[model samples]
Target: MDSSPHKLYHVHGFDSRQFLEHYFSDKSDMAFGDDVLKFPIEKLRQVFAVGHINGDILIDLSIGSLIHHLYSASEFFKNIIVLKANNRCIMELKRWVDERTGAFYWGHTSTLLQEKEENSDQCQDQEAKVRSAIQHVVKYDLEKENMTDPLVLPPADCVISVWLLEVISKDQDDYIRYLRKISRLLKPGGHLMMIGALDITYYLVGKDKFQGFTYDENFVRKVLAGEGFIIDYCNVKERTAVSDLTDYKATIFIAAHKEK
Candidate 1:
C-alpha cells in the first residue's frame, strides 16, 4: 500500500465512535479477538500480579478512549486518572464511566478479564470495579510542556500510555519528546507501561486514514534508555489477525521505571 498523501489526525478530527466499532467491538471481523483484546489484558494481568507497578495513582493516556487495559490496573491502584487530548474522547469515555445511555458495551471486555481471573460470572462486578476505580477523566494538551499544566496533577505512580505516539508524534525524536514530557508526570522511580506498534506508518479508522509513527524494538529501547528509564519487562507479540485497519508487524509492550 502507498504510504503518502494521507489525512493528518491533528488537522482532521477523528471519529472515536467509529474507531470503537471497527476494531474494539467483539462482533467485528476486522481482526481476531485475541490480538486486539485479550493479549494485552493477559500480559498486563501477569505484570500487575507480579507485585510490581502499584501505587495510589495511575495516570492513563492511551489512544482514543480505550479502557480494556485498565481492568487489570484497577485491581492494583487506588485512583486512576485518565488524561485525554480531546473533548470528544473525554465525553465518549465519560458516557461509559457514567453508565449513560447508548454507551459502548464493554461487558464483553469485562467478561474477558473476569474469565482470566477465573471469576466467570462477575462481569457486572468487574465493570463496577473499573467504574469506581477510575475517578477522574480530564482533558489535556500534548503540545504543552506540562500536558496538564495549570490544572496541577499530582505525580503519578505509573503512567500507562498505549498507541498514543502512533498518531500524535511526527517522528522518532518527536516521540521521545512526548515520552520525556509524560515521564515528568511520574514520581522518581515511578513506572511506565507503553504499548506501541512496530514498523507501522498509518492506520484507518472508519473511512479516514491517519498516520502511525514508525519504530522498532531497538529504537524503543534506545529512546527509553535515553530518557533515564530502567527497563524491567518487555514483550512483543507478532500480529496474527489480518486487517486493513493497521499495518503493524507486531505489538510491543514495555514496562520501565524512571531512574531515581
Candidate 2:
C-alpha cells in the first residue's frame, strides 16, 4: 500500500494475547474448534502427505504471533528460522519460546496437532519439542531486497508462509511479487507450503483494522505456475461463517516445490 506505514496496522498494533483469546480461546462456544482449527490441521496433514519432508533447514515466513503452523514443521526440520514483520510480533513469539511471563497459551493448539498426528497426548512434550526446534526469531521486511537482509541465511529446504502475503500486500501484483521474493529463499526443488484466506479484504485487531488481499484457488495456481513452482497439493476449506472475526470465504493451503 502506498499509504503511510503509520496508518497501517502492523504487528505493533496487534495484540497477540487478545487475538488468541478472541479467535482461538478454549471456550466451548468459540468457533476456534470448528472454523479456525481445521486450517492448521489440514495444512499439517498435507505436509505429511508430501512424504518425508524432514530436512536440515526450514524458513518460516509466517506472522510470528501465530505459531500453530510451526507445530507440525518442528518435527520435520532440524533448524527452524522464523522471520517476523515487526518488533511486537517478535517479542510475543520470543516470550513463549523463552518461557517468559504473560505468554499466550498455545498448549491447546499443540495438543490438537499432536492428536491429529497420532502422537503422544502429552501437550507439554509437544511444546518442548517445538521450543527446541525453533533456532531463531528475527526481523523480516517483505519490501526489502532480501526478505532477511543484513543477515545472510542459508537456502532453506522448506519454506512455510501462512496468512502473511494477504495481510501485507496492497493488490494482486504486490501479492505475486511478495510470493516470488519469498520463493527465492528456497533451495532448488525445495518445498514451499503456504496458507491464505480466500476472498478476504480485511481483519481487525482490537479496534484497528488491517487490510488483506482477495484471491481464489485458480489465481493461486496460476501465480505459482508463473513463478516456476510445481504444485504438489492444493485445497480450499469453505469457511463456516460462524463469526465475522475475518471476512474470508475460505482457507486455502498449497504445497509446491520450486523447479530447478
Candidate 3:
C-alpha cells in the first residue's frame, strides 16, 4: 500500500520530497518528526470514526494540511476552530491556506499588531496574505512560557495537537501541565488526539541547547490519565528515512478523549 498522503488520482510516485523540503528544511529533526507523517492517517481515521464530530471545534497546533483534509471530509469542517501556535509555521501554512482558502484561526505566541509594526513590508504582507486566504481567522497573543493562565480561546469540542507536546515542555510535569491547559480550552467531554515523538529535540525561544524529551507509552498514558483523558487507541512504531538518511524512532500516535 502506498503511504504517501498526497496521491493524485490514486497514482503514486508524486515525489513529495520537494514539498516537504521546501517547508521543513534541513530541520528534518523538527519538521518530518513522526507526528508530521503518521498523524494524517491515524488522526483522520480517529476523527472519521467519531461520526458525530459535526459542529465540533478543532484547534491545531503548528498548522498543517491535516485541518484541510478534515475540513474536506467532514460536515464539521465549518465548525472547527483552527489555531497555529508558532509564527513561522503559521506563515508557511497560511501560504498553503491562501492557495486553498482554508478557514481557521491563527493563534500567535506574540502579538500580531506588534509584528506588523516591527517587521518589514514583506513580513506584513505575509500576515495579510494569510488573512486573505481564510474566510475567518483570529489572532491571539499568549505568553509562550506560561500556559497556565486562563486563555480566551474559541470553545472547542475537540482539541488536536499533532507534534506539539514535545515543543511546550521539557520534562514530564511541565508536559502534563501544558497538556492540561490545552485540554481546558475544550468543552467538557471533548476528545483529544495527539501524536508525539518518543525522543525529540528542539530549541525553545532564547534557549541555546535544543532539548530532547523521551516518553515511553506507559509514561504518556499515565500523564493523560491524570488529565481526564482515557487512551482509546494507540500505535507505536519507527520510521527509517529523513533527508540526510539520519533516521529516528518515534512513539508514533495516540488517540484519546476526555471521559464524560
TM-score of each: 0.94, 0.91, 0.62
All models: lDDT? 0.84, 0.78, 0.49
**Most lDDT-accurate candidate:** 1
Q: In candidate 3, what are the lDDT values of residues 123-181, reduced to their tens digit?
A: 33433433343443343333444332244566667666765566456678867877877
In candidate 2, position 47 carries an lDDT of 69
Pitting candidate 1 against candidate 2, the one with the higher TM-score is 1
Between candidates 1 and 2, name the one with more favorable lDDT.
1
| Better candidate by TM-score, 2 or 3 | 2
Name the lDDT value of residue 221 in candidate 2.
94
Count of clashes, each model: 0, 0, 0
TM-score (C-alpha, index-matched) for candidate 1: 0.94
Which pairs, if any, clash in model 2? none
Model 1 over residues 1-260: C-alpha lDDT tens digits?
44453655544557888888877887856474777688878888889889878999999998788899898888889999999887778889999999999898777887788778756564457777888999899888877767777788999999998888777777878888888888988999999998887888788876677887888999999999999999999999998878878888888899999999
lDDT of 1 at 100: 98
Candidates by TM-score, descending order? 1, 2, 3
lDDT comparing candidate 2 with the true structure: 0.78
Model 1, position 113: C-alpha lDDT score: 80
